[model samples]
Target: MIQGDSVTETHQGILKLRVSSLIALLFVAAAASAGCSEKMGSAFAPSAVEGVVGGGQLQFHDADTTSTATQGIASGGKKARWDALPESEKAARKARMAQRKARWDALPESEKAARKARMAQRKSRWDALSESEKATKRAARKQRKARWDALSESEKAAKRAERKTRVRIAK
Candidate 1:
């Protein structure tokens, strides 16, 4: 089961444990029933667990070193990865993954997709305008700004008063 390099400080930060040590420890404990799940991921032999850490009880934990076999490529996609696997298992796993991805994609987005409806509405306004109509509208907008700027001082004060009365600022 120990398929890679020995555990070191950097690897420890990454959650790798020695499976060979675990297997050795299990053997020393006479736990023949303690079968190593070729997949359960360990580097220490079962017997090695009792080697001398603290000179007492054995230490065991979930190992995290990913094996070379977990390359994410579906080897023989239609075939079972494990001989014991049922025929339907592969299809079912694929179906589940597809569903998971769909759900993830469907999830509301914080920065993008969630506001799609709002964005589409805004885009629709832009999309509906003809090129010449848009140019005319831009000219009209500029004229409106210029007209507002040309207002007399009294006209500006009146407009500001009207705006103040119409707009209720929330606390």
Candidate 2:
């Protein structure tokens, strides 16, 4: 009877040990999965150290150092760069605009008339707006312009590159 009691005690101890080990293993697995989730989330997050240029070049900026990426870039702004382009490039751009205009010209007369009517309706709606409403809209536009002006040239280039890529992908 004493040996049977001892055997039962030993069995209970082994069962307890197994349960504790299983609980520890489960905790470790949960922590590992949480770590993996964090890594996966960060993989999709935007990187703060790198930017995309207009030419799709990766420009790295160190937080501890000043960025020299825009040093050699033209600094007269977008219009100035357009003005600096060669006549051939200007002509090509003009040709692209002309092509767009040609497409509009080729549209059916009814479609054009409908578009004109829509534009007139839009103008009428704007005209119907109260002075205070117009002022609010103008203020919003100014705020947007100021915010845009506050961005660095590299940031602007990155935004343009991203927009172009998105447009290309959408098309």
Candidate 3:
């Protein structure tokens, strides 16, 4: 009878051990699945990965670092090195930029489209010009620049005023 009881106690112990091991395995599986969910970018939680992810590039953005958009490379063509420009050129460039911004703001979508189309047409025509024609245009441009450079400061100011007046009238 004692032997029979001992056998029954051993069987119960084995059963308990199996249950504990199964519970441990289930917990391990759950923890592993949680890791997988993190990698998959679960909607319930924010993704661990940051920055722009596309085009086979993995950029990691940190709090102190500026975004690629602000650096002006991937978003569009490279920006001009503003710090390298002469002070005289910088003011003129700034004024021209402001004027362009104002003009762009004032234009309706249709007008903007028309302007873009006109620019495209002009570019196509320029591209179609023969090599000799291109050279002639370049020579004419150089001559105009030389003539402008030869003018006195007063003459240059007059020319600028005249150009401004012409532009205002055209607008």
Candidate 4:
């Protein structure tokens, strides 16, 4: 009977030690996880060098990107910095842009055909609308314009961004 009593006491002491060890391990793990999370936070945080400083203000700046990373900014030549560009170079760019615009303005047959089809479709849709439906649409447009005019600048910016995102996704 005395031996049996000693065995029970030993089991209880073993259980207590196991529980205590588990608790200590949990605490250590929690502390380690917290330290790791803090380190990760700092790692992802933006550094001071990632922005432009002007008038004691820091503005975030993104690096310029080209479609072909290996290619230079123009015809495998280094891009001239915008602020430091020579007047002659600027004039040449402007002339090139004007030439491109002129070429675009000379419409191709395919574009003309597409434009005609679009106009025809728009006319047909307009003809299909009842007078009451047209009135309703006009009222809706006025309401939308009023609502847009009432928006704050920041809200308008957000709305424009949302519209651009929608257009991109649609394309």
**What are the RMSD figures for all models against the true structure?**
28.6, 30.3, 27.3, 30.8
- Residues 1-171, model 2: lDDT tens digits: 347435576777878767755654564455455553323532222222122222222222233332222322532245577898999999999999999999999998899999899889888988799868987998999999999899999999999899887844320
Runs in model 2 lying further than 4 Å from the true structure: 1-93, 148-171
Instruction: Find the candidate with the highest TM-score and give its number.
Output: 3
Clashes of each: 23, 0, 0, 0
Query: Model 1: runs farther than 4 Å from truth?
Result: 1-120, 167-171
Writing each residue's lDDT as its tens digit, candidate 3 over 1-171 gives 346435576777878767755654564455456663434643222222222222222222333332233111342122345666789988999999999999998998799999899899888999799868987998999999999999999999999989887844332
Preferred candidate (lDDT higher): 3 or 4: 3
Task: Give one digit per residue, the lDDT tens place, for model 1 in 78-156.
Answer: 2344555776986787799999889777775663564576678878997699868877988999999999999999999
Task: Give the distance in Å from residue 4's predicted Cα in candidate 1 to where it truly belongs.
Answer: 37
Off by over 4 Å in 3: 1-82, 86-92, 165-171
Compute the lDDT for candidate 2: 0.61
* CA lDDT, candidate 4, residue 98: 96
lDDT of 1 at 77: 28
lDDT by residue (102-155, candidate 4, tens digit) is 876798868978878878988899869986887799899999999999999999
Where is model 2 poorest over a 10-residue stretch in terms of lDDT? Answer: 42-51
Candidate 4: clashing residue pairs, number: 0
The whole-model lDDT of each prediction reads 0.57, 0.61, 0.61, 0.57
